[model samples]
Target chain A: MNAAPSASKEEKNAMSSMETPDAELVARVREGDRNAFRKLVERHRERIYRVALGMLRNPDDAMDAVQEVFIRVHGRLTDFKGESAFGTWLVRVTVNYCIDRQRRQKTWDARFVVDNEWEGVSEESPEHQLVNAQIGEALQRALAELGEEHRTAIMLREVNGLAYEEIAEVMGCPKGTVMSRLHHARKKLQVALRPFLEEAGERDLADRAGEGVRRRE
Target chain B: MNDQDQEKLSLFLDGALAPEDAAEVARLVATDPEWKAAHRALKLSGEMMRAPVEQAARSANFDGLWAGIEGRLPAPERAPSLLERLRAFLTPPVLVGLAAAAAAAAYVATRPAPTPAPASPSPGLAATPRIAPAPESALAAAPADASEPVVIEGIESEGSKTVLVSQPVEPGGTTVIWLLDAPDAAGDGAAAPTTDDDPI
Candidate 1:
């Protein structure tokens, strides 16, 4: 019995030595650990930005939302209640903020521009970059045309990689509804991107043909 | 493929299917040309959609993010992201307690005395009033209610698993709707027993 107690205590110590969890960090922030709040921000900023981008579509608007979302997250720290995963709450806040911003401003800017900051990050040839940019713009256009619920479902699935159960919780919908939305969203995107996809497919074939001739040479 | 099969294909690709369903999907993909084509199309579109978001994430400069937010943090917790800056030059073990504090002091002390931290323009940042638990956040933009209205209370109180209820919220054609999950066999939400499952 005494050994069992020691073993469990050791296990706890080992666990404590591992990386701190979001919940523990939440507690620390509540207790006024300023650095813990920063740790939380560092860990979750990218995902939150992705969520914002998925909702708002404009890079400038999304970038702005990162600070807003964190502000909301910190201000409402008590209401967090630990009822759901902190990530889920962050997503909820982001989505809600985007919704309010859209409603208040009435600016449905349909452009998802590949801004200047992304100019030369990759070593791909200029041709590849141009082609990818076109595809990216095309994808954004198609995503822009989807219904609000459908777009959110796709973003949560592809961007956050959320499961059906978790997504349902975040969206306040049923598991069946989440799956149905994802299916319909995929179908819509497939239709919208068909022309570009076919063109890309033909290019792949042509490239393979050129490679075959080069090999024969 | 029917909608059901299409949905299954999406789930299968996501690896969200159960073993039996996955095996079934795999078998169909192996034998059926239609399923194969559908799978390929869905996969391609998904990849195309994902590329820009990944590109955006890669190119984003997150370094000044904490600086932008720390200034606007609510109440007494507002302090510069001192540790965030320290982590740029120090390893994790060096971040503990008084040693970390001393190292941070030293790190700042070594910098030329009058040179302040660079004020990188964090775009879209402002010192605005904060709404805790964000009072307006709950008003998410949803699809406007369908034009034609049908009777819903009958289906809800009968066998449906979820229900939409509306109550008039004052005057100007604005109605509030609640989407409530059906309580157990107790039937009515008001009558369901509450449990003491508080995490606090």
Candidate 2:
């Protein structure tokens, strides 16, 4: 009887460990459970790093921002009332910190100005690889040129894959505002990337024509 | 493109437009050359946007990051310091002292003035003024009267002089009083009675 109860208890503990929700982990952290807090950090660290990277556009700055975000989250964990999802709260904290950091450094205008050295894509056809690299560099340049608000909206929506509502919550704006920002951001990006897009389109058309000639011959 | 169409296109790209609206947008994109170009550009831009930020150069050190955050966390509750313990011990007494002082001042300010007894004037002494005693019931019932000046007879007494102190209990108000003292003709030949008629 004692052995059966002990085994069942172990199984229950394993089940809980496997399925603990963010809210549960947050509650445990609030109860001074350091292990639970560590688990929370591990769960959200990658996304936080990405969001920070998207905003700061520098890896070292992004990593630093993530560290600061987690430190703040730990300090203010008790202030979390569970009114919004923990991830939404975390994103909000991360974005605000990144934005503030950018503003203080006064380097918002200078971000992404330098062309990222193109890394070779080995698996793709040579022509396609060149086109893809050009397009990627152009896109990065266009994103850097966008105003901070527009860039942030795009980053939160695209890089982080946050839904419109979640984006609104993280941005502390209405859903309509998030949509509007995304619209403007995309428009600006489209204008900036138009040359690259045209180049890619022409390359595709030429490749198709060459294929047709080869087949006919 | 018009603002409305641009908005719809943005929403469509985000998969945020309603199904019916999305269908409309799709039809427009297929039929209109300008819309087609706009949609193509937006789609490519979005695809580029979604590209993973290159992580090879700057892979996050999760363990180091966590250690930094954990280090900054407020130190866990520790044994109280001597100063903290002393403060905790003295808090109740300090609060009690403040309360007692406030209560005593309120009592002194609100108490009814005593009635002056009639006495025959002495040879060189001036007759004390007979001020009417304030109504105790009125004073007690109207706590708001605390702001009004209360005239207390005989706040201080020397051999032949009585000092009547009239002071406003409210903060930042002035205190006015009258001191009745006889002419000092017998104590010393050089000393003369000086009446203090100043409002303090």
Q: Top model by lDDT, which number?
A: 2
Tens-digit per-residue lDDT, B1-200, candidate 2: 88888888988877777889999999999988678878998877655544445432245566688788888888766679999997887787898998999999998689654322212213343434434433445334434335443435443243454433343344434333333333452332222222322222
The residue-by-residue lDDT of candidate 1 on A1-217, one tens digit each, is 0010123777768965786999999999998887999988988888888878766766667889999999888889999989889988898888888878877877454455444313544687776677657655666677777777887887778766777877788888999898899888887766665666567667777989999999999
Backbone clashes in candidate 2 total 0
Q: Distance from true position, residue B42, model 2, in Å?
A: 1.6
Model 2 chain A: which ten-residue window has the lowest total lDDT? A1-10
Each model's TM-score, in the order given?
A: 0.58, 0.63
DockQ of each: 0.15, 0.19
Q: Report residue B66 deviation for candidate 2 (angstroms).
A: 1.6
Chain A TM-score relative to the true structure, per candidate: 0.76, 0.82
List, residue by residue over A1-217, the lDDT tens digit for candidate 2: 0010113778868966786899999998888888898888887888888888777777778888888999899889988999999988999999999999988987563233233323324567877767767777667777767888888998887766788888889888898888888888888887877777777767778989999999999
Displacement of residue A120 (Cα, Å) in model 2 is 6.8
How many residue pairs collide in each prediction? 0, 0
**Model 1 ranges off by over 4 Å:** A1-17, A105-110, A113-138, A206-217, B27-34, B77-200
* Alpha carbon lDDT of each predicted model: 0.66, 0.69
